[model samples]
Target: MSKSLTYTLLFLIMMIWGFNVIAIKILVESFAPVTITALRILLAGIVVMLILGIRKEFRKVTKPQLIYITIGALTGILGHHFFLSVGLTGTNASNAGLILGLVPLMTALAAILFLGDKLTILRMIGIVSGLIGVSFIVLNGERSVGSISRGDLYIFLAVVTQAVSFIAIKRATETMDARLMTGWMQIVGAFFLFVVSSRLEPDGLSTLTTGTPVDWIVFLASAILATGIGHMVYNKAIHQIGAGETAIFINLTPFFSLTGSYLFLGERIMVEQLFGFLFIVAGVLLGTGALEQSLRKHKQKRMAS
Candidate 1:
């Protein structure tokens, strides 16, 4: 595929993810957080399983692969959703978007710690800045400036789970098929959530029966567009080009998410929050070594001019 087309598709996918955050905040008005997250995971898992089964890629799993899948089910699926659903219930959708901007940075830090990836001086500074920025946002209360309510703590927890999951995924992708692992992880996570929700939330069983038409549409969109198909297309894009090329598009996710929140959900941007976001983003770029490449590109453009 041409570069332009690849980028266009990635852009569309990020838009879906961006819009998904807003959609969840809206849907939470009608559904419990646990209920929504469990249902979404279950539905997405079923869809991915059918697709993989049709492609004959759903091979019998080995014991080791099952272990990895189980770990991912715990961290990536169960922990991440629990944090995210609760976080969105009390936080600003825009805040969730900005805080999630830490994924690349957190993943890079995890890589350095666990995978022996290089951690440069700049990246160290970036890490510190990210810490300070996230702290400021999470520690501040609702009446405080640039505060995103106390729910920001849940978002940070979600980031921690995601960063850890990235490590698990890196190990799995070394030998296992990424899509299959993801599918199984989803199934495992969904089962965990279903059982837990059944116990914790009184009306969890009636989640489907309780939603209106709009809620169901939003729920399906969140499951299919933002997650199930989103991850599939993401992996395919990485296969077509490379992880780095695909990753530069991640910078767009926050922008799209914040914009969607602002336009659709009427979220207002805060200066302090924006600064914190920039700090976090800078940390991600520098920590991941993508900043150097960006600088090199700018220098080339200047020399060309």
Candidate 2:
């Protein structure tokens, strides 16, 4: 319940999410994007259903809640995974890492516009900083203008869809249990992916047929640990605290993504990219009131002594 503890939870959730991106990229290489996304969510959904079923929670769902959950699954789980996987196919891992840094800013903007939350000057600055960070990453890559990679555009599409889903979840949370909502959403979304993947992917079933022990570990970690449990913790954290503070936790994603990419994929980070990463972190910290609060607390302690 303490602010410090809440922040720590948020940070851990972000690390899980960051690692997930790297895991997703690996899956994309070995499997069709849609196929992997579908299977992961479907498996996660089954796990969630089992958990809820044990608690007799599955029987309480009403008609309207079902509809809302369906929409949530489509927008957040389905659309988000589909676009992100599609994007990862065309873009470098580094670019995907950086582009995701904009989530907090986008979430804030969506909250303000759709959820009637106030957008303060600090958040405005954070939005600008995030945009600048996005620009730096895009330009630093020296990507072709006319022949922009399909992957990069897909990343942006993922962002837009995710923003919509976050706002929807925020509104839906007023009446629904976050866990139940998330579980159903994943189930419905997974079904959609399963159907689509079945048609587009030949030998798609084979992708999951064989893998090294490490591969299987990472895949389960991605689906169960990073996603199923990760989202549960995240929604809880955000529900306890406010979204602004929770959004700051997302700043950790790029750092984790970069580290995971390096250790797993052997990707090297350039100096410019590192600087951009720092700026993104700073922007998120400042935008979320974390930096300011820390400074204020430090100054107060100094003056008291």
Candidate 3:
């Protein structure tokens, strides 16, 4: 495929993931965070395995690769996404969206510390600016957890964990097919979440059975479309585009999530959210080289014409 087509497809994948943040928040209203996340992963993992298995590439995983896949699943699927869902239970959709913007910064930090990737001064500024914007959203927003927001710290932890997971994927990408790696990771992560839920929330399965049709639809969307397809696309994007570029698309997630929340969940956007969105957009535009790319593209088109 052409570069533009590849980037466009990846952009759409990222956009889908933004919608998922809202879907997951909706799912959490009816299910506990871990239970909801676990179920989604389990269902999505099954679908991914079936897809991979049909291609005859599913059984070729080596022992070391399996270990990496397990680790990746533990961090990315279990640690990151589960906590994110739980965090949504206490945070506003827009607040969560703002926090989600930090994924790229977190990824860049993880890359520098763990993956030995470049950490330019401009990148540091972008990361800090995004963090500052998130802080404004959190401090002024109504989310509170017993003197603190319930998911504030948890969601932050989730962001950090996801950053680490991104780096882990980057490392694994050197040796693994992004598809197989993601499929196995989700499968293994779902298993771990199942075990965790069994020990911690034994009532989870009962909750699933008790939910309404809307709940079921939300869960399925979260699992099948959001977690399965979205995450798979994310893994591929990271593999091909590298974490920094892939991470840039994440900044768009808050915009999609906020819009989804407003349309579906009856949530209203606040001034703080609007400002946060602007700062985040500006930061991301700088971080992703979008402004420069646009200008260059525009100049080329004009010159050509």
Candidate number with greatest TM-score: 1
- How good is model 1 by TM-score? 0.90
Model 3: per-residue lDDT, tens digit, 1-305? 56576689777876777777787887777776677788788899888778777877666777777777877888888898778877988886767877787776676667778867666666567666776676667766564434657676678888888878866676676787887777778878988888888887888877777678988877787778777777677766666765445656776788888888788788888887878777776666655444555677789999999
Over the full model, what C-alpha lDDT does candidate 2 score relative to the true structure?
Answer: 0.77
| Pairs with backbone N, CA or C atoms under 3 Å apart (clashes), candidate 1 | none
lDDT against true structure, model 1 = 0.80
Model 1 bad stretches (over 4 Å): 139-148, 293-305
Clashes of each: 0, 0, 4
Quantify all predictions' global Cα lDDT against the true fold. 0.80, 0.77, 0.75
Where does candidate 2 have its weakest 10-residue lDDT segment?
139-148
My TM-score estimates for the predictions, one after another, are: 0.90, 0.87, 0.87
Cα-based lDDT at residue 61, candidate 1? 79
Tens-place lDDT per residue, model 2, 117-196, is 76667767876777767666665655555655778778877887788887777666678788778888888899988887
For every candidate in turn, the CA RMSD to the true structure comes to: 3.1, 3.3, 3.4
Q: Flag regions of model 2 displaced more than 4 Å.
A: 1-8, 55-59, 286-305
Q: In model 2, which residue pairs have backbone atoms overlapping below 3 Å?
A: none
